[model samples]
Target: MPGSLEPLDLGVQIPYHFRCPISLELMRDPVTVSTGQTYDRPSIESWVATGNTTCPVTRAPLSDFTLIPNHTLRRLIQDWCVANRSFGVERIPTPKQPADPTHIRHLLTQSASNSNPYPTRLSALRRLRGLARDLDKNRSTISSQNSREILVQLVFADTGSESSELTHEALALLVLFPLPESDCAAVASNPDRVAYLAQLVQHSSMEVRVNSAALIENVLAGSRTAELRAEISNVDEIHQGVVSILRNPIAYPRALKIGIKALFALCLVKQTRNKAVSAGAPETLINTLADFEKCDSERALATIELLCRVPDGCTAFAAHALTVPLLVKTILKISDRATEYAAGALLSLCSASEKSQNDAVAAGVLTQLLLLVQSDCTDRAKRKAQLLLKLLRDSWPEDSVGNSDDFVCSELVVPF
Candidate 1:
């Protein structure tokens, strides 16, 4: 027995037509899509679940979103599984079919109906969430059937009540599943949505706030008009909500990321930048950097660089002690892109105020700049670092440009 030959790793090959087009796995519960192509149930449902309205194999637009079960094919697949059992292939279990559209429609009507029982509404919401979770085809059905309005309505109702449970589920679905452009535009038209979302940021739980921020980001990204976003971020409450999330020590990393991205989007307006600085974005940014991993620091620095272009931005960033040193650390260390931001931020500070220039020099920014210019950073970073270096040398003539505690640069030929 010890000298017996071992079996090779080669396994049985299944028929090409029997394999799912998307996942290339044996189709356990094969289903025919609107495009008339067959795919495994979960795989096809997932394709539609991602908000796509097309068939994976056919690449044809799905005018019909319904999925038709292939009972005959499934039986054949089962027979194959049984035949291949000796080859170590197990039978693929039958997957439960998604709820019928009529059932989903009835639940939607009941949930949106004014006189529906609260318990019934909760049950319908749970069932709707389940339907949404099961199939991408269902998302198309929901969106096309006007149930997106109901989902949005539920998210809008996410008050600090028992109904918040429903809202949380609804919010996840809206963000995870892509909303129709019309749906996003419809929500954007509602002027109160901004303040409404901000209230959640202030008073809601961390999950709700994150969902709200993501929704806002999504809505903003889907818009066609600058006027829409300008009006959205101009409100003090909305601006503060975004900054508060940035400064929120306990906010999840995703919340912080979306919040900063939202803030960046809002700061495109000159009026909003002043509001962001007034809302204490600079200090919060400094605190964020102290604990941020490399990725977060790049985001924070990019925001700082953007804000630093204005006079008030320079004032706010210069007032913070970690602003200069942090910029120095991020340069030539985190990433070339971050180094570019760091250099741009330094240039803004030194350009706006003489005191900031001297402070940057004292923070070993000069040596960092020399290293940054010599390092394999972007052309923009090298140029900004060189400009800031010249400005520092001209302003503080006696202060050695390279002879700092961080590094000596007497022999370092910094290209002027």
Candidate 2:
């Protein structure tokens, strides 16, 4: 015979100590054992009283035996126990392993060559995207040199691709990778890396532009004097390019938003500030705000907010009075979600002086904010309204009141 062993029937002769006493087939909640036999509640109590808990078949001693639990059965009992216990503890699922990078590259290669089935390629790419994020999370598991190599590969892959979506995904991974500050410094210092990022900012894809903007922001935040000076030397040309794109009617909304944020950040740097201002940046922003064709209301609002920070620029334009009124109208016309936030910025600028306060009151912002307080809106709006009313009350000349007590009673009431 090729393979033959007679099956032995030990069902009748098996020792009680060797056989698992718990019902292997019909196991239920939290069952315990005495000796080698399993018992339900009533049987257990009877066994304890009679002292006859040895297995009925084997006659093995029942006393002083271990209470070994079936793993699966114990889980069910644990669930019931938890429900009856304290509410503080919580059970969580374990995390899984990240996908392999070599697998990802294989899928990408297959997708490019059209060698694999379309559906499989797409599925593999999706998995690869997830794996990239996971790898970013566990970046510390890899050596710094390896991490840098991977980052460089991603940068190359992102910029070399004609597919906008894939490039955006690759660029996104750059942000997700948790590099140490020193590594960031190294990236910024490396000429090749800087050139690679600068080129990506000019990519045709708006997603690439946005991600590049974020990369630039992160890099510049810790840039050294030499690097900063190099960037500053090119400020006018860069600002003009970015501002042109921002002014373009066909530019993506997200791209324009990022460009505006990046511009604002650049303007905050002392080396870039004067150059940007001299490049007719202020006039360009004012023109954007005035343009009805642009449909960049959010960009316009951001520009206004950024302009407010540069007091000299706001003053130089002779548009201080117009700023508050435009802001108020924009607030009223826009959704209520950002209304109070817009109002707060306007108030901050206008309330800086008694003259400006008078200008704001004349703009009817005070009455508008007061009406907002009466409406059922967010607590933020109500708080802003209260702040505006207080500012208005405080702006009145203190010497104008003969007695402080009268002013207190008339203007503000206090309850005991």
Candidate 3:
């Protein structure tokens, strides 16, 4: 038998001869023995089930080594297990500190002093950055209303005489802060706040414009108010600013990218549909389709993609100057893969028009599509051809059977 255990005079005493082999710390999962020998919980459990008759360390003869855990130790084990299982990992605890008004004031002051003022000292900048990171991580800690207010204040801070850098930072901060629906409601409720964002959409710097576009997207995602949607729709100066960028060949691609993103944002609002319709957004889109003919193949394809997204009702205008034949000829002329993709888009527009659809069928659009379908080309083009054929079959007149040679292909007939 092992000698009686000695009592050590240590300030802090831990139970068990061996630390928990699993955790490599204190004996968390504890088990008691018949001879009152205690072992790490997991070790004892394993031994009890295996019908071991003696202690591994003491080697004492054991008649009945009942494994019972200490209540306190069991609770700790349960809690640790739950936390591990629930979170799937342990999280490092962050120290709690009182809110520092001075830090907030300093950030605001710096923002006011420079158009793009960041912390001067490396330590301070790191700390500020850390705080921003913490705020992002613990966003649920603050109420939605408070978070939006703080974000709005940050957005409004004036950075000294340099407007560009400061504006960029402010916009960056706006994008970084994740606000809830309630917060968006609070920020958008205020006309002045919405107006401030509208102004940023027209800011001189492209960086600012890009950031503003992102902010608008975030705001519109949660917006429900018709009045707010109408206000945004009516911002002609901002729209013109965006349009001017799109019209400039040198800068248009970048600007059009932003404009398309912003338009997507506005489309999220149910009320903005009428506003877009009223603003002749359809006409603008049609114009883009026409402009595609003059642009590079890649750019033309992008323009076609954007044009397809124009509201469905806008196809009524296609019968006038934007005839189906013109679009088909344009598509047929280009040999690039992208131009082939644009041809698919043009087909969609042709289908959209009541008059154009009839004209397209008569003018051998189906024959051309069948040839493209059978050609050794991209899967995207082939898939588009399949879709066009399906749409044409569904739309074909009852008496229009056996009129076209292209429709008589073996593969097409099998499917039909």
Candidate 4:
């Protein structure tokens, strides 16, 4: 009835039963209520959500508004649409079975109890994964079951085999969902779980690795309790996994950003800086910054700023041959913020010894500072650079240092 024959374009006529009583459109996710009438799930849900007690069709005082799935009718409707594809009717997909808390608990229990190899356990994990990913209700359903411990056990369980196909699947489910904070904490709870993530960061597919790093970073940012924060920080492998991301040359830019954020978060706690340094964080971050071939300078610089906070962190930076040079190179070449952070790192690293001070001068930092004082850098950066310039000028070997006018603060290329 809605189509126009004169224009020679007539849409297929939809059946009345296929139409929702409230919305007057083809039913998607159709459900039957107590009044024996079917309607689209969203419309009925909205009607009930608004506190209406009576059924739309019957106006009856429906004591029970349970939305029973109209599966048989849904199947027939899908079949009809498929049969009439030539009429421009698109087949509806088989809707995912509605989430059941009972079923989720049962699957989790089975997942825990089964001692069989991965095939049997994988089946339940796959089902649980599907339900968790398909809808928010399912995610809430699984979360309410307090499934984190179960998931962690499955994920970190020692399979003893080389191929971790099932572990990877479970990891994917854990990382790819909007899970509860408590659930995410379980991933960082113990050394074994943290080790699993570190291993994944090294060997798993890019998606899984990225998600793993991100999950660690997220937990760092928003873990619920103080004890949980301490627990997460104590795991050394979490730091290793984050460092590995920056160390990986083939990682994508977004993954690299997430990795840098993890470092930033991890570096906030004083106790964790030693773990980061032990994880080769300084070297990995230096390489990441120097990888002009494919790098994110903004986050790289910010992470370096955080890493330099620890004394051992500074020692690590100074030990790396390229660390000072890379920080100097980033000045004025990348963003102004990078320039500020680069200046900050130099201040932290070279401010102590006469030899390190001279090394900063040799690294073209003096020239960069002169330019920074005059360039469009941030005010904070300009002030710091000027202070460093004064420090270097005072510390310059006056006898052999050609002339005060030679270091006369002209704009130079900064020796990137």
What would the TM-scores of all predictions be? 0.69, 0.44, 0.44, 0.57
Highest TM-score scorer? 1
Each model's Cα RMSD: 7.3, 17.0, 16.6, 9.4
Candidates in order have lDDT scores of 0.73, 0.51, 0.53, 0.72
Candidate 3, 116-153: lDDT as tens digits: 52544223323444555565323323222243455455
The residue pairs in collision within model 4 are none
lDDT score, candidate 4, position 163: 28
Worst 10 residues of 4 by lDDT: 1-10
TM-score of 1: 0.69
Superposed on all Cα atoms, model 2 deviates from the true structure by an RMSD in Å of 17.0
Q: Choose the strongest candidate by lDDT.
A: 1
lDDT of 2 by residue, 13-90 (tens): 222222224332212322356554453333344454576656543577666633434444445434533443343322
Q: What tens-digit string does per-residue lDDT give for candidate 1 at 189-302?
A: 776665566676565577677677778777777777876766666777777777778766564677677777677777766666888888888888877776566776777788
Model 4 local distance difference test score: 0.72
Off by over 4 Å in 3: 1-149, 157-165, 176-179, 224-231, 234-245, 248-254, 268-271, 277-280, 283-355, 358-364, 367-400, 403-416
Worst ten in a row by lDDT for model 2: 1-10
lDDT of 3 at 35: 68
Residue 333 deviation, candidate 4, in Å? 3.0
